[model samples]
Target: MNERPRGIESVLVVGTGLIGTSVALALREHGVTVKLTDQSPGAVRVACELGAGDEWEPGGDRVDLAVIAVPPQFVADWLLDLQKTEAARFYTDVASVKALPIEQARRLGCDLSAYVAGHPLAGRERSGPGAARADVFLGRPWAYCPGRETSPRAVAAVLSLIELCGGNAVKVDPVAHDEAVALISHAPHVAASAVAARLVGASDTALGLAGPGVRDVTRVAGGDPDLWTVILSGNARPVAEVLEAVATDLAAAAAALRAVSVDDDGAIARVTELLRRGNAGRSRIPGKHGGPARAYAVVQVLVGDRPGELARLFQVAQDAGVNIEDVRLEHAPGLPLGAAELSVQPESAEVLAEALRSHGWHVP
Candidate 1:
């Protein structure tokens, strides 16, 4: 990336949370002066301490760009207030939903020509300054939604922001961006929470029998509920539409399961077809770096619970001359061994498994 975005020497990040700090840190790395601010002084202080950027000072030098990273509900008001000052030449936001904020800003009579809306389709299950990483946007798509009357300079500035963070800039309309995210992000979050919610009143025995399948489905459900509530509220319509479609599928699956349990005719075929459709839908998801999904082979190994075991496993895998695509670890209760599942390119799985066993590691 360029050392600094053209004509953008300094940036004022208006929130010090995860996304805000990440943007500041990434910009600072490329020689852009950045000022960090938040409603809470302590939050800004922590972000600064983490080397995201310098603390914002009153009457400081004006910035070339100002990024409003506040919550969805406060975005319009904050943008309006910032526009009233000569704080920045170009204004953009990292809010999850774009259309509502843009509409609100228009109603508030904000300078439409100087503003654009952007959202990075990336995040961790964690939140806050503590979880911020400069590389969070790498290999992610950052959607840029400029208002109809937005100027070329404003669009370029926001595009530079995305490039500086190592993200691909995907130009999209505000309404289209909202709908896409509802299907991919917002609705999935709600679904994950629903799956997790089922465990709240589950019996201890049922919980004990859970495995990676349950854990995977409910992982994002651990996110901050308060923040999710605000986001869901902001993009309520699109999210509701997506959830309604999902509910229809859920009803079909439920009815099929009930019919199968009763040995009804064609019940097995109905269940199988639903499962096949699920496989098809899941296969459409892009693989690493937005490429077509590739099937990987999993090689499971039982390793002793000892110091340096994981490092040794990796060393052996490297010695086998196979690249590992992914990995997972599962520990058995009251056992000294844990299962390490390594996912490699399908053609190399058996070779890697044999090599690991040849090196005295149990491969199952």
Candidate 2:
């Protein structure tokens, strides 16, 4: 682990949610004193119990940095209040949307020089302090938006914070950051929710027939709706713009499907083109190590529904000296066994499969 940044001996982390607690934990691990606070006293207590940080109290020594890990809508208000109190020499936030909060801070007459906006592009499907992991930001992009008026010292402090968390810091303008996340993060979340909403009226048999495809598409939809509502609404314009384009594509897809139902041969080409474009778009997403994405090969293993089955499967991969890039479990309704798809680099896939077979595991 890297040493804590210079002059940042202590940090005041506001809002002891997943991101806040994770930041506190990472900072505390690096010998930086962290003080935790939240509107919900219970949340702060939970985070403190998790060793994220000590409970924050007024009249404490001034900290070098103050991180506001609140939702997008609440960031500006906190920024204004923190400034009124001279909370820290520098301040930053971990809100997903940037432009709104920046504009709000400006409107509130807060000192821009003392504040830098930041967002850590890391999270799980779960939320709250219990789901927080100290290593969540590792190898992920932590974006910082320091406006023209933002001080260099503030920017440096935030960059150091990202470094302490073992994250790669990327500098971006606030407006650009908001627009980018709308397409990549915010809008996709809305689309996922829309797709998942269709399941509300779906027959039990239809839902039971769902495979990894549906599960993967709707996975993010499982996120807290109340939280996402605030996020989507905060970036409403950008998100809506992207959703409009998605609607166009969806309409075309529906028309093509309808045409195919009528046995129109030309509809197949249209559907194939849409799918091809999707493939091309997906391919453009940067992969690990900042290189063009490499397609991984998957080896499926059948595991009986019992304790330690997953642990045994992982041990098999560890013994084979194969690094699993990703793993997904798919279980059909009423099935006693589930299939675990272990994704590895193409060369390692065959090796992994062979090794699992030799270990008396079903690799089919």
Clash pairs for candidate 2 = none
How far residue 261's Cα lies from its native spot in candidate 2, in Å, is 2.5
Q: Candidate 1, after superposition: displacement of residue 257 in Å?
A: 2.1
Q: Please give the CA lDDT of all the candidate structures.
A: 0.83, 0.85
Q: What is candidate 2's TM-score against the reference?
A: 0.80
Model 2 Cα displacement at 283 (Å)? 0.5
Q: Write the per-residue lDDT of candidate 1 for residues 12-102, one digit (tens) a residue.
A: 9999999998888778767888999899999999999888889888577878899999987788898888888777889999999999999
- The per-prediction CA RMSD against the true structure, in angstroms, equals 7.6, 6.7
Error of 2 at 269 (Å): 2.3
- How does model 1 score by TM-score? 0.79
lDDT of 2: 0.85
Once fitted onto the true fold, the runs of candidate 1 whose alpha carbons sit more than 4 angstroms away are: 1-5, 288-364
